[model samples]
Target: MEASGYLLSGVLTGLFLLGTVLVLARNRNWQHYSPAGDASGVGETVERLAGSPGTWIGGFVLLTLGLGLGTLVVVGGLPVPEGVQGAATVAMAVVVLAVLAGYVFLGVYHSVRYRGLYRSQAAAAGIWIVATLAVAGIAVMLLTAG
Candidate 1:
């Protein structure tokens, strides 16, 4: 059972990484599709708010750290005091929930920003939702596994 848990965590981590790459690619594509001079209204607003690729890269790094720590805990590689384990579990849960919420927000933003060209954004959002759920499930398993 413990081995299986580790395997699941590994799979979820891979999925998360893949989803992150897809999102970054999509963001780049959006920038190219609607260059500065071409964008108007919502597209322009989104382009400005999205900032540069560096912003997304920084966000990805932070996300990787959060998820990596949670994965380590889930796989029983991290030791925690009994009392503190619960707090760690809560923290992981919050992290996963925040990621899920961020994906949902991106979906909405893309829907508005891309308007007629939202299929890719929708697909990326769906992938991210699944990845976030997998991470959440892994966190729950880790918290309850003892």
Candidate 2:
């Protein structure tokens, strides 16, 4: 049941992130953009940011860190040791911070063309981060207390 709770929370978090990305893409007019064509200045900026290698790298890092930590908690059999809940809480806070940083990066990276999208992304990212933290908090509480 605990594992299920964690998995469910993670899935929900991912879905929210995906939705935010989709909305950002749409708002930025990047839904079907082609960087190889007649792109205006704004389009060029969009292409540069959206097609940036750094975005992909950041995404990869997020994927790796999230999976790595989750795997450690599950496979390493590191049950919430007594008094260690603080550590788990801190770690979740860090994850939330990372998510916020990523959103900021996305916004700044594309600010040249997608200012509106950046704002939307920031709002959506905040929502997702809060939701994830809430779920993770619940999971940790259950794991530690139960």
Candidate 3:
């Protein structure tokens, strides 16, 4: 149980870090077409990345992390740290919600900004945001009861 909790924590951390990097990559045109400024082939490039298998794979990874974390918390019977119930639970929920919201905003903005590469990439990001929120909600519930 402890190992699972540790694994889940690591997964969550990695997902957060990866999401951050993906946002930056889109913003900086790092994930855009190679030969950066070439507007001609940009559409094709964007389309490929947006619908790439990699995006789906990454989304699944995030979803798994969220589910895994929630499961670990339940199975391990971990209690919320003292004084972290009620409003504190609400506070943690808010923080996690904010993170998920930020991810969504980033995904939408990036999709619109780079319409060419919008589909796959944006879907992948969106999935992570949704998964994160779901897991965060469960985490808060578990913590609140403890």
Candidate 4:
């Protein structure tokens, strides 16, 4: 279990880092493509970002990371320091919550900003919500299991 947890953590971390880099690269490409000015509004920005393959892949990576981390915690495989396990767990929970909040904010902002162009916002938000909830549920189980 411990070995599996460590492996999962490493894999998840790599995926998350890769996703982050790809997203940044996509943003840079966007800037180069649109040298004139910034995106018009939240809607346009979200649309552009969401339309990219990188963004979609990155979203999946993040979701996987959250789910994997939660599973690790619940399985009692996370190699957190014995003395700081509670603090570590709380910190991880906070990070997962923040990611969820970011997704919701993006979806709501885009929907509100571009009522007409709110095409994929719902889908994105739904995935985020589901993933976040799954992670939260697992984390809760982990906390209570002890």
Candidate 5:
């Protein structure tokens, strides 16, 4: 029964997105598209960020610290203090969301500041944000079910 509810929710969300995409297509909202073009500047954005020092190094350092702490908690059974035991999980979630937002913004932020992009980039980003929000909402519902 629980799984069925999730499936139903997923199906409804899928249908909604399909309808949205169809409407957007009919309206020609998916513009500025280049199947094989090098004008989006997104590649340069990524390359610019990657070429800087400490980009990969900082990420790996954080990952290593998180893994080490997680291992200590699970394997070593380290005792958490009275309060804020769940702070780590909440902080991790925030970090994940921040990273996701930054990545998504990267794919669309050039519309206002650079060429080869327009409303289409922003529209695509909007669609993705909506879909992700819907999925996250359903997941939260399932996880919080008592």
Candidate 6:
């Protein structure tokens, strides 16, 4: 209670509330899926966003760089005096990077193998996930830094 503070808890709670709102909005607004469940405006929007160059660039930045750095910040502690705390931080970093890399690879492969298009939508879904997580992660880190 004395060492950490309420910043982390507040950030987490805010993120959870935001997620809940998003889910609710999705269910309420985008509930017009066709009988097949695939034919919907959401699909078109996804395809469009995926095809956009911003998606690839942003995805790369967010998933690869953002998550990579964010994970280090977290595992290394909020304000890591140095690069890592101990072997544990290094090991945790390795695990996280590996998972992040694998996730990126899978998302890119899926986007290419399935969602075929002209432009490069490397990690469409992963980008969205990364963006959402990074925002919250950044918020928390910023609070901790303060």
Model-by-model lDDT, in order? 0.73, 0.66, 0.66, 0.67, 0.69, 0.65
lDDT of 2 at 40: 60
Best by lDDT: 1
| Stretches > 4 Å off in candidate 3 | 1-116
Q: In order, what is each prediction's RMSD in angstroms? A: 13.1, 13.4, 15.8, 17.4, 8.3, 13.0
Give the top-scoring candidate (TM-score): 5
Candidate 3 per-residue lDDT over residues 1-146, each given as its tens digit: 86578669867887898899778877864445435565698888888987999987997688667555554454444576544334445554565676667667676757654876555566676666677667766766765664
Tell me how far the alpha carbon of residue 79 in candidate 1 is from the true structure, in angstroms, after superposition: 2.5
lDDT of 6 by residue, 83-104 (tens): 4546446765666766776676
Candidate 6 clashing pairs, residues 3+ apart or interchain: none
Looking at model 4, which ten-residue stretch has the lowest summed lDDT? 28-37
TM-score of each: 0.41, 0.28, 0.28, 0.36, 0.46, 0.30
Q: Kindly list the per-residue Cα lDDT of model 4 for residues 1-146, writing each as its tens digit.
A: 87568558857986896798678757743322225655568878888998999998998898778767765765579776655556556767777777777767666656654765344545555565566567667766765664
* Cα lDDT, model 2, residue 88: 54
lDDT of 2 by residue, 1-146 (tens): 87778769768987997898788767844444334666468877877888999987997798778757755664444776645555655676677676666675555546533555455555665555556666667767876774
Model 6 whole-model lDDT (C-alpha atoms): 0.65
Q: What lDDT tens digits, residue by residue, belong to model 5 across residues 1-146?
A: 98788779778987998899788768954335456766889998999889977898998798778856855554436887634446665666666666667666665555433655566666666557755775777677976786
Which residue ranges in model 5 land beyond 4 Å of their true spot?
A: 1-14, 29-49, 70-79, 93-130, 133-140, 143-146
Better of 1 and 4 by lDDT: 1
Candidate 5 residue-wise lDDT at 93: 66
Q: Which residue pairs collide in model 3, if any?
A: 46-117, 50-120, 50-121
